[model samples]
Target: MLFFSQFQTPFWFSSCFSRTIILFVFVVMCCHDDIEAALVLPNNETIPAIYVFGDSIVDPGNNNNLLTIAKGNFLPYGRDFKGGPTGRFSNGKVPSDLIVEEFGVKDLLPAYLDPKVELQDLLTGVSFASGAAGFDPLSAESANVITMSGQLDLFKECIKKIKAAVGEERTATIVSKAIYIVCTGSNDVSNTYFLLPSRRSHYDINGYSDFVAGYASQFLKDLYGLGARRIGLLGLPPIGCVPSQRTLGGGKNRDCYEAENQLASAYNAKLSGLIDDLKTVFTLPGTKLIFLDIYYPLLSLIQNPGKYGFEVATVGCCGTGLIEASIFCNPTSIPLSCPDASKYVFWDGYHPSEKAYKILTSTIINMHLKEFF
Candidate 1:
């Protein structure tokens, strides 16, 4: 009787039915947009540049100006990179370059140390990541290199220089409007937390894991306070899977260094929990603070090479996994050349190949960004 009465109601009563139809349409649109797409243009808001921070994996050339011998500005390193290597730690370009490229950045985001870069480079983007950094600052300090916090200081210095050049108003706009991408933590485990016998004696693996997560959380909070309205926090990748680490324990008869890889996996899990805690601290609208899981994606490539397109996924083409990283990664050092770089996942012993870097960037953009833009 109620249904019949409603259907038989006057034409003026049809507004509710119209609202229902509108709501149905809105639901359909929302469903289609469920994946969030920061891949799109900055909608109504400002996202003119990207600020890159982390270790050599994402470092552009922060070490170029420094007198450190750990530099990638030489040939063979950038021979395939836009006609010449410009100190990027990767074989070709890294994620930092791929991001600005995919976003259709007009000018190339310059390394903070590039003398050729103008004051306006900061507007497009600027790479301030040091060659050494992790969840802890001690890794870099122990190596006598710049730590993550030290890199942030370098970023601050760049900001100051930019302000002097472009005035406070424009500099403020550039810093506030850009996206902050931070990728760190691997170094801390390999160097400070794991490599240091003193640290191992002090903190067990779980204790070290908690300590790392705590440091990461605090650093992220600092970034938030530094006018980083939009930020993408990348968790640590499978550190044990790196060729160098793999060579450390195993004799190739078995498989991976399961112990280290499991530690890395556990750390990422803890990081996921940390991100959840972080969200409660901030409930602002339109502020993106997402944790991208590169480990899963990169590990997928290693486990299933056919998914991406590769024959060999295990070994690096550069040098024998034995003595290829650290003091051995030299483009000029023909002694380090591998037979087939494309087939292997890692380029050298430590970092991924250009192809692998490409996949990492694509996965982060396509798999993760559908919701955050």
Candidate 2:
């Protein structure tokens, strides 16, 4: 007994200590993939899904299959994406995709038009945005792109599929719990109102802004009818500051078109009031409508590029960003793109780069998304 006790102490301690060290290493290696997944998927995810809408700013790849010039399913566009050229407008991810990553819902939000997208993907989330789409029907028509109404129709179809897959009860929960983000209206201002001259001739800038706000309000009401409870509506960014607009319309100095800036400001104010009215109108106990002010945030990023670690604020990385966009942003035609896209705020004339998007989303999360979580 005495000999056994003395031998047991050393034997047990050495065996247990070695086993613990080996176990620790083994566990860490075993969780290698899980650790990576966790980095993208936060543990504190509160939303069940994130449904996104709007123009190129949020379109994943819906326009990839569309027969429009607003497509981006080619090189240099998705140069930084995993499989490359997934039809996102930026060098990599867009605002909606980054927001989904921020919410820890999914690494990539599938485009509703992507044939590979499965029922499971829909249950999680999807983007119904079409590049070049706008609240104004004419803006969409001009680009030969799907209008906001058409996108809403697609959402209706999506709902039907969700109901078929998970039944009505689960579908309702998903729709209610999901976060809906809208980032349209730039095209309405840039394409329809300012460039076209039709709307501009009829309604003054203020009247035109009010007209757009009315349409925007109707859009939210339509979503509410579809069971969307939590909403994030991004106001217009500085459309005047976009490289394409500045080049085409900015006259000699190439300064941001002042009249266009005034138009955006006027529209934004009306839109803010519209959002406030929407909250009261959408009276579903927990319905939350958040109007994200991207105008100032984006403008500040442009005015103070160094503050945000960006070198170029006016031009994009693809070709002569002063004019290139969509098909014009083709790598074949340009034969070269900026080696480093992170330094540039705009990806190609209009859209923000993935780095710019990440910064914008982080700011939005810090400022407003805290309540949602």
Candidate 3:
């Protein structure tokens, strides 16, 4: 009767409308499943959104407009993506793009920096990751990219807009339920500490790992304070085995840098322990902090390429597959890419190929479906 009251009808006709009201109520009350099916994403049954934060590993095109050498808005970069050269470090879709596809919403996650992004896109999700950003401000500064804190600030600004558009309650729900993925730390170790001598001069490997872990802890805490509950913290891969790192060592004759791999392993362990500590220390009741392990699968692929049906695990598809990346991967200098990118593990020098990224993301998602989805 209350539901029927919404319709304008005379009180004299109330008796005549009694049967109609009963029928209307029966349809609404009994056909709840049908109504919910019509409302798509009802009760956030599907992940309402996916918020990505990281460096080049997950960066879409956020670095394109920034004054950064980490930019990838050029040919041979996005040769396999929908739109060419969308600032993804890889030859095609990055891990974030493929991961979002599993959610069954958007086919690819757009960059937060894209000017065309609308309120609807914000409600779904966006990637604020820059190609070269790291947990350390120094690393981001060196790459001329947005820092981790800067990404959080952008997210906060986005939240305000969302609140204005859809009210505070819905905005909070969207943010709380959205999946938050952070894929940094590689730049901190690979770019900041290893490449630059200043950090090495100050702290050794142990101290450096702790320092990075501290910053990572702060990052997660800040995100939690912003209402994020489901967080996927991607562990550092074996950066020493990347083509660029290997090329820096000695080009073709060089082996995997064991020292750098050891550093990454230590950092991954500390980060895992840090997540455990955060879960215990924080009072977030519904919070789910997940540590995504990418080391073993990637290691297996690298060590035994044939087992994974990959012909080239040591080199990239772009340029000479050595130290080339970003601007260095231009078509003019490098010419055309390999006929089949699936054969190669790395796309350029630092990032993985689209096929490799798919495999890695699939493994991670399968491993942590319960925690995230």
Candidate 4:
């Protein structure tokens, strides 16, 4: 039987907060009778594997071995995961793992950089994503993590290894048949342009969006050139609404920053259009390029948390919830972290909670699984 702890709120909290907490607890108890049942894949459409590439949102733990502050291999980061943190930038599985799990591919998608990964694991899939990496070259550079180009290079190396192990024919089937998920662009908008003044000096929001979109288009084309036929490119979420952004730019009360959200929406529009154009441009016989919109779905959850069995949307479950991620959100912050991550939309200042990710991944798969075929 699934169990949910009662929602706890201070007495000084407003009546609205009390009502929302009650609603969240009630909804979780009644709607989610069995936690595993909620996670069961809606369809049995299994793929050969799931290859993920991009930023912290999809990164399983590629940044662990790298000399970067973006690492998440520590306590509290993966308190809910089976083994431990494993460098995933969430309280549990990130979207990369959830994607594979929901598709009946595997329980966890190991990082390509992980030393324990073997030939059998390679046959399934692996994430080349690095925490803090983004489409903008400067974005990854600033964080000292792997660049998008670097990830592609790793993918090429992975292909060679697979070919060596299973021969060219089998390797080709895996590479072409597997679902390739590219989740990026959030850091490009949130950190590269907004937080850092370097890009903003040259390009306004419009120009910057175009700049990142161009890189995104090239990356997809390159992935196709490397044998990925079915690709899912994720759009940026409502960046300004995240806890970090809310604290940084959302004024004294810390409301969702509209300017940042506008930038994200603009970029999403360009990315969606580019995906359609790329499909028409790709000469490959079976090219499937899809733009998965995580913007509105995440926005809805943030706007109305109670509707999704969550009470806290503005703040994350980690630390103060305003600004703490990666190394900053460490074991020391565990005392400040929320006891029940399921009731919060975000695990840290940036990434979503496992529950939120499960819901998002399920929605994406159910809506677009047929399109891949």
Candidate 5:
């Protein structure tokens, strides 16, 4: 084992050790004034708040109250979180909470439908995401979750509440200045088009990608019209590489499902081009639209797990780690979850572990922070 003290620190260490140090420093900085000091941009302008809209990737607890099977409000879900299971899909804080915390805005991004959310929470923003939601309306309809349009309707209500609380001017400032994060489309590719025959019978992979990208374009346009000037749209990750997809489509040996991955890449390509076009065509002045690429970052961690201090990248830490996810991953399962989640890239078959999320969030924020301004 290697050890070092504050005064006798070595100049070199293993890549994993260095990564751990970086993550440790990041967590430490987030504790107090250090986060503000470290996150100071050149312009000194801070994000007023953060509003999230997407699927389970960003959903905190919106699915808890909904009559949907996509819920994750049970043990081993938020087991690592301070408040216990609050409906987050992962073991602890999801990307929605991480983004807000990284920006020093707040500790958690409460779900809009959460009863605990107060007027003060609305000013800082709340998540309008639902588990299993997607850009395609049918995807959500099939899962009995909120659709993209339905989330927008909720957002409109949220805006009305904010306006009522702080007047129109302040609401406008908060809406325009705050960062809006859109992270969905995984369920659309992995579930609706591939697994379900309804869409596949009518549209091929390319056609379906276009279909989803069209809806995504419209969503961005609608958000822009609603006074959202700064938007961070996340591209789909490697859905095929997740454990559940691997078990289903990766053949008997369980390799990465290339077909689903290709669909994700195609959709991302189309969405990226659309975002660029929207900036020049549909967007008004002062609009900052960026397509955050989560594909390669997650792919990197999976392809080379040791570089990021992860031992199990192909499976999850929950239950069997091959097929268990959401409700399937529970305490009553035959075998309990792994004792140490830090060594795993995924918390469940579907969602990344909290440690992996922190790494991804850091990579994404570093890549796009300057572009947002």
Candidate 6:
């Protein structure tokens, strides 16, 4: 027992663990601060916080307080989130959770709804995003949930909490230094253009496209006004390919709902244009405001699944991909999904699988992080 004391950390990882502990102690003693980084690359530069915006893809737990149908605080949803409930969509960790891991901080980002959080928690930052909103302030409202504008209102309260904890000047530095990740627009495309009969019947395709673009523009300005310096805006992925939509619209017989996907792509293109225009309009200097093209990246994966090691990319990992989301979504109320969850690209009708998330996260870290960081 005495001889094995030094190796008690585990034979395979003892040396690495010791070295990591020492490096952590060394850095903690000297560095000004460290934050939950979003990249896996060896960039030791520390920021103050990460303030997230937009919808479910990146939201930690903002929906905990909302009465939205698009919530994930219940069963099998958190089966993989370790021994406790965390309100994340995935069985375990989402992008925010992995992002915090990349930063070397294993503690989950304090959910804005968690009553146990104190002042320091607010200083480190929190997520105010809802599951169904994006550039559209009315997106969440359409579902009778919280909107992007409503999220900003929550952010105002968060800022006040942060100001009290860290002081206004340091709070400014914290907000300015931290990266802001905005992920949304999928729900809007799914709900508005395709699902909602109201939108389809009233406005022609072009008119609705114009509405999405105009709203997206104002959304960026709102973030800029709130002191977001470094921003990473994500565009919507291939909506026509999502299992639910494919099953609903044409039953996946090559009769894809092209109209919806085109609108999504068009909105994404307009978003890119608006980001380019922001340099002149917002006059942002010394801080980066960038767009991460999640649409194209995800599209390539779906188009060439063999390249990504995916055998079946057309349907979901859940039951039949059509009503599969409803099945696996609330297992206690409904039935559990199938056993071969890994075979499909999507975990449900709308979300990606663990394998897909790993691929996407690695791509962002290895490929596009230099531009944002």
Number of the top lDDT candidate? 5
Residue-level lDDT of model 6, residues 1-373, one tens digit each, is: 0000000000000001111212221111112111122332223445566666666666556677766676667665555567643555555556655545555434556567677777776776676766666565556777665677777788888888888876899888777776666667777676766667877787676667667778777777887788877776666676777666677775538445576678777867877777788867766455566666666566676788776667777776554555444224765532545455445566666666655654565455444455553
Candidate 2 has what TM-score?
A: 0.86
| Angstrom error at residue 143, model 5 | 0.6
Q: Tens-digit lDDT track for model 2 on 52-148?
A: 7788888878888767898888877898888989888878877766656644677888899999999988987898888777777788888887888
Q: All candidates' lDDT scores?
A: 0.62, 0.72, 0.72, 0.75, 0.76, 0.59
- TM-score of candidate 4 relative to the true fold: 0.89
TM-score of each: 0.83, 0.86, 0.86, 0.89, 0.89, 0.81
RMSD of each: 12.8, 15.0, 13.6, 9.9, 9.0, 10.6
RMSD of model 2 against the true structure: 15.0
Score candidate 1 by TM-score against the native.
Answer: 0.83
Candidate 1: which pairs clash? 35-370, 35-371, 36-370, 36-371, 37-370, 38-373, 78-85, 317-338
**Tens-digit per-residue lDDT, 1-373, candidate 1:** 0000000000000001111211110111123111111233322233467887777777777777776655667754664678587877656776777667656564345678677877668667787776665667676677666676776787788788878888999887777667777777677766566678877797777777788888888877887777666777776766666666677655665256676666666777877788788889877654567777777777787788765666666666555544364346665455657655556566666677766675666656664553354
Candidate 4: clashing pairs of residues? none
Cα shift from native, residue 139, model 5 (Å) = 0.8
Tens-digit lDDT string for candidate 4 (67-158): 88988899889999999889988888777776566445678889999999998888889989877777789988999999899999999999
Q: Which candidate number would show the highest TM-score if scored against the true structure?
A: 5
- Which 10-residue window of candidate 4 scores lowest in summed lDDT? 1-10
Q: 288 in model 4: Cα distance from truth in Å?
A: 0.5
Predicted candidate 6: what Cα RMSD to the true structure? 10.6
Sliding window of 10 residues with minimal summed lDDT for model 1: 1-10
Query: What lDDT does candidate 5 reach at residue 281?
Result: 79
Off-target runs (Cα >4 Å) in candidate 1 are: 1-46, 67-69, 106-108, 331-336
Give the per-residue lDDT of model 3 (tens digit) for 167-276: 99999888887888888877787778888998999988888889888999999999989988888788888778878778776346867877777888888898889999
For model 3, the local distance difference test gives 0.72
